[model samples]
Structures are given as structure tokens and as C-alpha cells.
Target: MEKPSPSRRAFLGLSAASLAGLSGCLGSLSTETDETPGGNTSDTDPNDGNETDSDNETHEEPTEPPGLPEGGAVMFVYDDGPMEDYTQALPAHRTFDAPATVGIVSEWIGREDYQSSGCMDIEHLEELVDAGWEIASHTSEHTTLGTFELVEDAAPGAERIYPEEIRHGYHRGKTIELTSDEHTFTRAVADYGSDDTGGYIAVDEPIEEACLAGETIIRYPAEKIREAMGDSKHALEGMGFEVETLLAPYDNFDDYSRKFASEYYSGVANARHGKRVNDPEGFDPYRTRRDYFIEYTDRESVKRDLDEIAERGALGVLGAHTFKEEVTEDRIRETLSWVDEREITVMTLREAIARYADR
Candidate 1:
């Protein structure tokens, strides 16, 4: 069932000091306006329908896009809390006095297995928080929050079964539901496996009734989703860091996840993605958009998007996985330079919400 959406005041409850702090970081923005896109203005009078040669020649000066404090804003978000974020991306951003938002996987923090693979530890993340960075939740284990379907069938008491593994949504300890046209069975994942046969999930309890191979597998219930969202925020806050946002694991979430996220987070960075920028008027903090900057991403295309952002005075969000081989420090620095050259404001996702979102 869908849950009630929380109001911004109930969720953020920004105090006078908090607002002052935000204003200190991001100085005053221009008041909201009703200007059209491209800041174009029409000087022609509608009532005076008489057309003249001089009327065609007269042009109105362009103005700032509506709903921003001034010009466009960009937010750089690093996903997965990798060691490279602290080691590589931080220095690049520091060069231009820009702050970034990072989505942390709670279980991966300080875990030897993950640390060995170049994930960030608690100490590394602390340094980021100290440097004006925003720490957001990417969930406890980076579990996929979206639902997928099963590949094979099983009877009651069966503990293991095949699922469409390409989604990579299943994990041990996660509660899941198997739903068919006629019935729904909820079970906790005991283990996850992949081999020559493909990927499968091992449930803790035996299936109560027969389910076919094509049945749908729901990854989370409303209660569990709420638990995951709240627990991740609490875990980070428990570490003395302010966590007011979420970056959905695997950039995958549905209406249920969105609803629960608002209960615990002020905003979500990976809510959507594409070439478009967010409009501040009636902005939905939970549905903010972001574009990926992977190794294969085109530099020119990103520049064009930035151009549009500056021209329209909109909010542009860029997300990246800093740990990847091709996403080097130089590449990150170069992107920051682009935004710098355009004179666009770069702030953390949390700050953007505070500035642009309607409260």
C-alpha cells in the first residue's frame, strides 16, 4: 500500500541557525520570477495591434531564468562511498572550492572485504564530512530496491529457487515476497548465489505454498523499506555526521521507496536521470534528477547540457562512481573546471534542496 507523503516542514524542520548556515554558504539568491525559458522577454504590446517596422527591430534584453537565486547551479554526487572519492575526487573539488554529496553504503563502511576492494572506511568518510561534503545513504548493503521476477518454480518447504539474476537485486538477510496471480509469500533471504546455472536466492523459511517460475519477486515490503531508510540515516547520524538525503542503491527505486525516503531524507539525488535539469518552481526534492559521468560519457555532450543549464538558470545534478578505472582524478577536475569557467554555482545536494526546493 502507498504511504502518506511527509511535508517538507515535518521532514527537514530547518531551524533559524540552519537557514543562516545555508545562507552563509550560498549567499542570497534572486527572488523567484515568472520569466520564460532562455530569459526571453516580449517587448511587443498585445493591445496595440498596429505593426510597425521599428516594432520588429526593437529587442528586449534577456533576463535570468525563473526560480533560481541567480544563475544555474550544479551538484556533483559521488556514489558508493569509494576510497577514490576521498583520495581522488576530493582534491579536484577542493581546487575550485566546490563541495560534493556522497551516497554511502552502510555495510561497506570499514568492512575488510569492501575496503580491500577500495571502498571508503569510517575515517575516510569523516574527513569528507569535515570538508563540507554531504553524506547521504545508499542503503545498508547497496541492495536493489526495485522488484524483479523469478525464473523457475518451487513448492512449499523449498528453500532455494532461480530468479532473473540480471537485475542483481537479491541479497542475503533481505526480506522478499514472492507473488503470483493468485497468492503472495513473504520470506527472508538466507543466501544469494550465482554459478553456471545462473543466480538464485535461498530463503530462511520454507515456501508455504506452490509458486510458478514466472511469478514476481518483490524485494521489500513497506515496513522493511521504512526500516532500511531509517536505519541507514540513523547509522550515519550515529557517527555524528548530518545525513539528510539518499541516493538510491543501483539508481533503482519505485513509488514505495520514494514515499519512504521522504520520511527519513530531505532529498534523493538519484531520483531520476537524463539530459534535463530540474525546475525550482514546485520542485520535488525526492524526485530530483541526475546524469551519470562514467568513462564512456561524452565530454561534449556534458558541456552542452551544462550550457543549457546555465542558459535556463536551472539545477543540474551529475553523479559518478569515482572508484572506476576510467573515471580518473583528472577527468573529475576537468569537469569542475568546466562548471567553474561557466561561473555556475556548485553546492552539495543538501544545500541545493535548502535553496531551491519549496518548503
Candidate 2:
């Protein structure tokens, strides 16, 4: 099946004739909108009252709340913490401004999958935390929690491991998606090896179950993500990190997913498909995006995305992963240098969340 791209009807997906038109009309004025629920951006906050508010409650056409933060905003959420993020990308973030949060997959932190085990070291994370980079949970494993049903034994402080499900090709099943039997969301921390503290949970542990406990924000690939985030907050705390924001898997969150995470993060939610619009010849850090500038996330497409945001008065967020050899490091550097030269705020995902709260 040809899955639709995030930017359907965008420049990237436009037909040859339409694309030519778009290219010609791509002057200073053109607009596009992506209001789809699953194009990687969603509101999954937990409604914890802290993260979410009915700020736009007025009946005046219910526009975005005024007195909010400036220009709404832009931010960066680095997902998965691949080593490249640490070695190749972080310095750029630092040069611009400290990032707000760095979501990490606990299981992949020190382990290698396909030899791309995260390049970030524990020390690097520690340093980042010291440098004001808020650390948040990206799940113990990079599993799509929503799709993977919790077994009976799942419980708090008790980590449980599901058998490998079939992967993409050749029917290598890794998990089986199903509805929750109990139908209540909760957290499980299998008390891995040591109940002492800061220890890894193992596969075999008493499965303790509860209604999805944790902080509100979450990101799972299943249909009902709220339930999957159950009690995940405390579970993450047990791992020695104060759990706050929960970025979506692949940065993919729909409105529901965003509602869940907002319960805790209580700020603007992060999305994968933010836009980038800067000077074509040069770049204004205020209006530029490294991912977009590097041509990694489709710059022209992003410019159009920006136009939509400007019209809607809604917040816009842009995420970036490491630019691989495929995209070329030189391009990445050029984008970063532009941000620094322009002195853009270059806020981190967490910072944006906090700012959104103020907004």
C-alpha cells in the first residue's frame, strides 16, 4: 500500500503540472494547510489541568487565545536520541540555544539495534541535563505502546517484556495489537533486577496493572494511546528521571495522543510536520529551520506549511533528527550556522512546551 506522505497535496506530493504551478507561484505568497489528525502532530495531553487549559474558551469564533506567547512559536523535539543526535546535532542546538527536552528510548540508550544504537552516552545526557536540557521519556523500548496490549501481569514498578512480534518484511511478527481486556489504562515497571533503585527491569516480573497512571502526555502507535500511557509517569521516575513530556513515536501524535501528553507537559504539543520558511538566498534564524534548510524535511513544503500557520494563528513546531551521510553533514552545518548567525532563539522541545503554557 502506498501510504500517504505527511504533506499530502504539498509540493512534495503535487503532480507534475501542479508542482510546476506551485514552483512558479512559490514566490512570496502561497499557503497550504495540514489539519489531518495523523500527519505526525496530535493533541494527546492528559488533561491534568497543568498542561492543558481551555484558554480559547471565549465564543468569539473561538480563535487562539490572545496574550499568548509571541508569534505563537517554533521549537525542536529530538526524538530517539540516536548517537548522531549527540555527536552530530547537539552542538548545533547548543550554539543556538539550550533545547527544552530530549526524549529518549530507555531500552535503546546503551543497546545497539542494527548497529545504530544511540550515539549519545550516559555522560552526554547527564551533561545535557546539567546544561538545562529537560529529559523526558520516549518509552523503555521504542515499541508502539498503543498497539501492544498489556498482559494481565502488567503493573507499576514491574517491567514486563512481550515476545518479539513480526516485523515489516517476510512476516517477522513482533507484536499483536488488541483491545484491552480490562479496558483501563495503567503503568507497569517489572522491578527488573534490583528493587534498590535506578536498575533495569527484566522481562520476568510480577505483572502489576492499573488504569493508565503516569503523567498525561504519551506517544504510542495503537488506536487508544491514552490507556497505553497509564501510570507511565511514576514508572519513568523510577528510572531516575523526572518524567514530564512524552513525545510521540516517530514524532507521530494525533489530537487524542496530544491530549494525553498535554495533561502533564501542559504546553503546546510537539509534531513531526512543522514548516520552514526563510530567505531563499539566505536564512533568517527566526524564519529558518535547520531541518528545512538542510532540505531534509522539505523546505519549500515547510514554507507553505508556515504560510498556513500564519493564517490560522496556531503554533508551529519543527523537529529534526541527525542529517545522515545521505543528506550530507555539510548541508546540516550550513543550516546550523545560519541559525547561529541570525541568533534565532532555537528553543528546545521542552522550552517550547513551557512557552506554550504561557501562551
Please, what are the lDDT tens digits per residue for candidate 2 over residues 102-142?
66766556555524544465677776766556666665555
Could you tell me every candidate's TM-score relative to the true structure?
A: 0.73, 0.48
lDDT of 1 by residue, 218-265 (tens): 567777777778888888889887888889887776665776777787
At residue 244, give the lDDT of candidate 2.
56
Tell me how candidate 2 scores on lDDT: 0.42
Q: Write down the TM-score for model 1.
A: 0.73
Clash count for candidate 1 is 3
Candidate 2 has its poorest 10 consecutive residues by lDDT at 163-172
lDDT (C-alpha, whole model) for all candidates: 0.72, 0.42
Clashing residue pairs found in predicted model 1? 29-69, 30-69, 152-213
Scored against the true structure, residue 222 in model 1 reaches a CA lDDT of: 74
Best by TM-score: 1
